[model samples]
Target: MASFKKTATGWRADVFKKGIRRSKTFRAKREAVAWSNQIEYEIEQGHHDTGAAPPNATMYHILERYRDDVSPKKRGARWEVTRLNQMMRDPLLADVKLSDVGPRHFSAWRDKRLKEVSGSTVNREFNLLTHACKLAWREWQWLKEHPMAGVSRPPENKPRDRVITDAEIESYVETSGFSFKTPPATVLSRVGAMFLFASETAMRGGEICKMKKTDIDFNKRVVYIPETKTGVPRWVPLSTKAIKILNHVLDYTKGTPTVFCVTASQRDALSRKIMKKAGLEGINFHDTRRTALTRLSQKFGPMELAKISGHQDLKILQSVYYAPDPSDLVEKLE
Candidate 1:
């Protein structure tokens, strides 16, 4: 049961159920009614929590705990850590106490962040925050109710359909300081080989960086990927060109365990520098997957392409990766 009274400052609502009492003061009577009703409902459902979080516990602390205890177990730990660090820097979201945190803070944050970044970026952050809050509410019992339950996610930006060209690929490789005649010996040469190899193999930048020299089966023309974005291992068949590039990289970095000597971050930085030097715009390293899949589609059917690309969802494989030129389709139609 709940009761409300008009106070000098605002409306004060008090709820008592299951021998537990909760009270809150809101600026408006409607707000008080809403809060009291929610409390009563939670009590009836046996989900009410009268205690757990410390008096001064803030969203920052929850996020910090999540970063240390949860994020490291994920495959995208690097990205999650980076995003969580950025989130903690914002005082509006980080400093708010668990009891006082509500949808308004997140709504304000979303509005401000939309001005600086794309909707997709903010949505990713929202996902991380949502999961953190869920854990706090259900697993950690840090909040009486989910704070983010009332907040709506921002509209996602359209997916990237930017396709890379062969000429641009050649220019990117040439600008990366790798030469066909000379063996790949420098880090820049390895980056170049990574770029070319991405086009041939469609392996992600991280996967390429994590590639072990021992994983390559030259006899079978296949490379076994023990770790992947999908968390499932798959054997990616190597093309003749891919094998040649691997052999070139092997000749130089033989002492190292990994094929490519650069981390994903290093590959991204060097790739951006090379792309800028090549005068290319709007093409990212991941675009190589789209380009490679488009080229692979010319020879392999949907099932075979899915196998090679490690895409369990054929619809995603077709919609996102298999980008064919209209002119090429027309040529084939003739």
Candidate 2:
């Protein structure tokens, strides 16, 4: 049976048919009656379930269980754990019980969160929540069904392509030859050439920085990136321009195990220093790879760009593809 009554501060609606039921406070008698009516509707719709009280479960307890027991067994689990902890720090979902969590509660949380997040961010949090519920569904076996079983996450927003322009490239090559943009030594000037190498070779900074003479096959013009982002063994071909830039870097780093293996922020500082030094604007080292990918896609095809960029997805290259120049196309045709 459901009931509504006037209270000191407001009206109260209470339902008595479930094992774990909730009562809500309303400001007016009409509001309380409406809430009581909705409660009945929910119960009639079979949304309200009856079960024994859930064992004492807290937000932290679920996180610890998911992180250590479930997450560790999955690939890219560390990132999941990090995201979970960050989401937990949000006050909205912190106090809600895992057992009491329903599609309605999740929807309310999502609606509240839409004000503060991008579509992609909202989708990401929903995905994280879905993943946690999936783990619970597979392992816990205690829950009847995943709370987010039918929840609809927002569509991912289109992300900007990370392409760099030729003017930017020219500025970058000129700057890399100069003094270090940051502190300590003038050695950081290699940042400019580093950007050039990345642009020409599509080599990741970390991989190229760790490259040694033993790893290089100058005769073959192939740099073996023994480890890659996909955890698959792969090779990246060296272009003549890339060879020239790397040769310069090798001359500068004649005796070192790691070549320009500074922290990413330090690399950013070096780039800014070079950008300021060269009197050029809006160029960064990371942009070089994007530039290279974009240029390659225009000249060759998506497959070729994917081959060079180590991207398994051709759609990625297509997304960043800039139109080729007609004059340049005529020259290539000739």
For lDDT, the strongest prediction is 1
Clashes of each: 0, 1
Which tens-of-lDDT digit does each residue in 205-249 have in candidate 2? 766666766777889998787767667656777888878766666
Q: Whose TM-score is greatest here?
A: 1
Q: Candidate 1 clashing pairs?
A: none
Measured against the true structure, the TM-scores of the candidates, in listed sequence, are: 0.83, 0.63
Model 2, which residues run further than 4 Å from truth? 1-55, 68-82, 108-114, 140-143, 159-162, 170-193, 204-214, 251-257, 264-286, 298-301, 321-334
Candidate 2, pairs of clashing residues: 176-192
lDDT of 1 at 71: 100
lDDT of candidate 1 over 148-257, digit per residue (tens) = 88898888887778789999999999988887689777777688899899999888888999999889999999999988877789999999999999888788788887
lDDT of each: 0.86, 0.65
